[model samples]
Target: MGFSDGVIIVLGLALFEIISSIDNAVVNADVLLTMSERARKWFLFYGIIIAVFVVRGLLPLLIVWASSPGVGFMGALTATFSNDASVRDIIERQKPILLAGGGLYLVYLFFYWLFVEPKEYAFFFESHIHRKLSFWFYAVASALLLAVVWITIRINPFIAFGAVVGSTAFFITNGFKHNAEQAEKEIAHSKMTDISKILYLELLDTTFSIDGVLGAFAFTISVPLILLGNGLGAFVVRYVTIHGAKTVRKYRFLKNGAMYSIGSLGAIMLAEAMAVHIPVWTPTFITFIVVGLFFWLSARELKAEKIIA
Candidate 1:
C-alpha cells in the first residue's frame, strides 16, 4: 500500500474500533465504579493490555488453532487469516459459536441485574413486562434464551451447544447461584475480587472484539499492523472506561444506560446467532446515541431539582 493508503487504513481502523467499543467502555466503567481509585487505575492499565493483546489480538488466533485441531498452531494461524476470504470463512464457520457465546453472556448480565436489583435502572425506563411480571421475569428470560438456542439447534446443533456452554459459563463463573439466593447476597458479585473483575473485563473484551477485526480485514491481513492500529483504539477505550467509571460513580442514570446497553448487545448477539446478521456497528452506534439522549435528559432533571431546592 502507498503511504497515504496505509495511513488512511490505520485511521479508519482506529476510528471504527473506538466507535464500536463505546458500549464496552460504558460496561467496564460501571464495573470499575466499585473498585478503589488505585485499584481502578491498576485494573484499567492491566485490563487494557490483556484486552488488546490477549483478547483482541491473541485469543482469535487461539480460536483459529482450536477450531482446526489437525493443523499445527503456526499453520492454522497463517491459513485462517492469510487473507480476507480465509478470515471470513473462519468467522462464518464459527459464527454460531461466537454469537451463541457472546449473546448469552450479555443476556445473563441483564438477567442478573434485574433479579438482583430490580429497582436500579437506567434511562428511567422500565420494561412494563418486566415490572408486571416481577420474579417471573426469570422464567421469561430463560424461556426466551432456550427458545433461541432451540431454533439454532434446529439449524445447527453446534449453535445450541455453544449457547448452552455460554449460559453455563456465565452461571458458574459469575457465582450465579449465590446471586439467586436470598436478597442479602445481592451485589456480592459486584464486590468481586480484583482478579475476578479483571477476568470479567477480559472476557467482555474478548467477546466484544470477535467481530472487530472483520473491519480490519477490509484493509490488510498483516497481523502486526492489525494489532498496532486496533491497539491504539483499545488504549483510548481503556481511558474512556476509567473516565466513564468516574462519571458513572457520579451519575446513576449513566450506569443504568450501561445495563441497557449490555442487554441490547445480548439481544443483538442472539439475533446474529439465529442468522439475522445485524451489522456489527449497529449496536455500537445505537448504544451511544440512546445513552447520550438519556444522559442529557437526566442532566436536565438534576439541574431542575437543584434549582427547585
Candidate 2:
C-alpha cells in the first residue's frame, strides 16, 4: 500500500504541479531570455534550488502547520513531525478555506484577463461579446463560484474568512505583479545586473506559487509527497521555462490549453471547497482532453489548407 500507492500519488502530484505552473514557466522563460548567458545559468540553478527547497519544500509544511486549526504554529509543527494524522486532520478541516482562497484568486486572474482592458489585447472573448467593462461577463463566472463560497462559509467560518481574504489578496497581488512586470521592463533598458532580473524572476515565481501550493491540497496532504512531487515538477517547470518558448510557438493552441488548465484547476479547487467530490486525477485528464481537442482541430485545419493549396 505504501510503496505502490505512494509512487502513483507522487507521479500524479508532480503532473498537477507541472500543469499548474506552465504559465509561470512561460513568464520565467521570457525573463530569462533577456539576461546574459552566464547569469542565466546561475540564476536558473539558484532559482530552482530556492523554488523547490525553500518554496515547494518548506512552504507546504508551514502552510499545513500554520493553518492547522486549534494548535499554535510550533504545536502544529510538532504534531506534523510527531503525528502525520494530526497534520492530515488539521488540513482536512481547513480544506474548504484553502480551496476557496486559491479558487477565487484563479477566478480573479481569469476575469482580470478577459475584463480589465479588452482593447490592449485581442482575445476570443472580445470578438464574441461586446461590452463596456466586459466585467459583467466575468460576473457570470464569479457569481456561481461566490455562491458556492457563501454556502461553504455557513458550514465553516474559516472558509468565509478565507474567501474574503483571498479576494483582497488577489486584487493587491495582481497590481503588485503588474508593477513587478513594469519594473522588469524598465530594468531591461537599464544597467542593472543580471542579478536584478534573476531576483525579479524569483519574486514573480513566489506569487504564482501561492495558488499552485494551495491547490495542491486537492491532491494529497502528505508533506513528503507534496514536496517530493512538487519539487520534481518544479525542476521540470524550470527546464521548460528555459526551453519552452519554442514549444509554445510550435503548438499555439497549447498556450490556450495552459491558460484554461489554470482556470479549470481553480474551479476544481472551489468545487472541492464546497464539498463537491472530484477525483484527484480530474485535472490531469481534463487538461489533456482540452488541449487534445485543439490539437486535433489545428491539424485538420492544416491538412485542409494543404489540400486547398
Candidate 3:
C-alpha cells in the first residue's frame, strides 16, 4: 500500500474502533461510577495499557497466527510487511477462512441488534423488525448459518468450518455480554470491592475488545496497522469514557451508524471470501458514508431537542 493508502486504512480502522466501542465506553463509565476514585484512576491508567497492548495489539496477531499456524507466530506478526513471496502466499491462502469466520460473526452481531436488542429506533424498520421478527431471531440465525455452511462446504469444507467457528464465537461472546449486563446491574447496587470492580471491568473490556479486533480484520490484515489504529482508538474510547460519556449518549443514532457500517463490512468480507472482487478501500468508503449519514441525523435530532428544551 502507498503511504496515502496506509494513512487512509489506519484512519478508517481507528474510526471504526472508536465508534464500535462507544457502547463499551458507556458501560465502563457507568461501572466506574460505582467504584472509588482510586480504583477509577487505576482502571483508567493500567486498564488502558492492557486494553491497548494486550487486547487490541496482540489479539490481531493471535488471530493471524491461529489461522495460519504454518507461518509461525513471528512470521504471522511480520507477514504483512514481509517481502517473502512464500509468507505472502500462505497469508493469501488463509484470508478466505479468516474472512469467513469474522464476516459471519459481524453479520450476526448486526442482526442481533436489529432483531433482539432494545434500542432507540434509528429507522422505522428497526422498531418494526424488533417487534415483529424478534422472536424468530434464533430461527433466522440458524437458517442463515445452515445456508452459509451448505454453500461453503461445496466450495471448501474448511471454509465452512471457519464459518461455524465464527458463529460459535458470536454466541459465546453474546452470552458473555448478556451476563455482563446482568452483572453490571448487580455491581451497581451491591457493595463490590474496588479490586473486584476493576477485575470485572477488565473482563468486560476483553469481551468487548473481541468485536473491535475481529472487525479490524475487515479493514486491514496488517497486524501492525491494526494495532496502531485500534490502540489509538482504544485511547480515544478511554478518554470519552472518562469525560464524554454523557455527550456521546446524546448522539443516540451513532450506535445505529456503527451497526450499519458493521453490517456493510460483514457483507464485504463475505463477498471477498467467496472470491468476489472488492476494492481494497470499499470497507473504509462504506463506513465513512454510513457513519457520516447517521451522525448528521443524530446532530439534527439533538439540535431539535435542545431547541424544544
Residue pairs whose backbone atoms clash in candidate 1:
122-256
Please provide TM-scores, in order, for all candidate models, with all chains considered together. Answer: 0.62, 0.80, 0.94
| TM-score, ranked from best to worst | 3, 2, 1
lDDT of 3 by residue, 213-235 (tens): 88888888888889888988888
| Model 1, span 1-309: residue lDDT tens | 477656665665565566556655765666666667877877767777787787667755664455344555776566655654664465557665756765776677667666555543443336554465567656766896678777998988878887787777666656633332322223224667766666656665665575455434433434555677788888887877776545444444654555565677677767776888565346546556656766776687678767999
Predicted candidate 2 versus true structure: per-residue lDDT over 1-309, tens digit per residue: 268666766776677677667656766676677788998898778888999888887777777665564666775666556765765566668767777777777767666655553332225554445466565755765585577656876778788777776678777787777776566556556666788778877877776677667656656666677788888989888888887755644443444444455577778877887788987667556656765665665566556767999
Question: What 10-residue stretch in candidate 3 is worst by lDDT?
Answer: 76-85
Please identify which of the two predictions, 2 or 3, would achieve the higher TM-score against the true structure: 3
The count of residue-pair clashes in candidate 2 stands at 0
Off by over 4 Å in 3: 78-84
lDDT values for all models: 0.62, 0.69, 0.87
Query: Pairs clashing in candidate 2?
Result: none
Question: By TM-score, how accurate is candidate 3?
Answer: 0.94
lDDT of 1 at 55: 68
After TM-score superposition, what is the CA distance of residue 153 in candidate 2 from its true location, in Å? 3.5
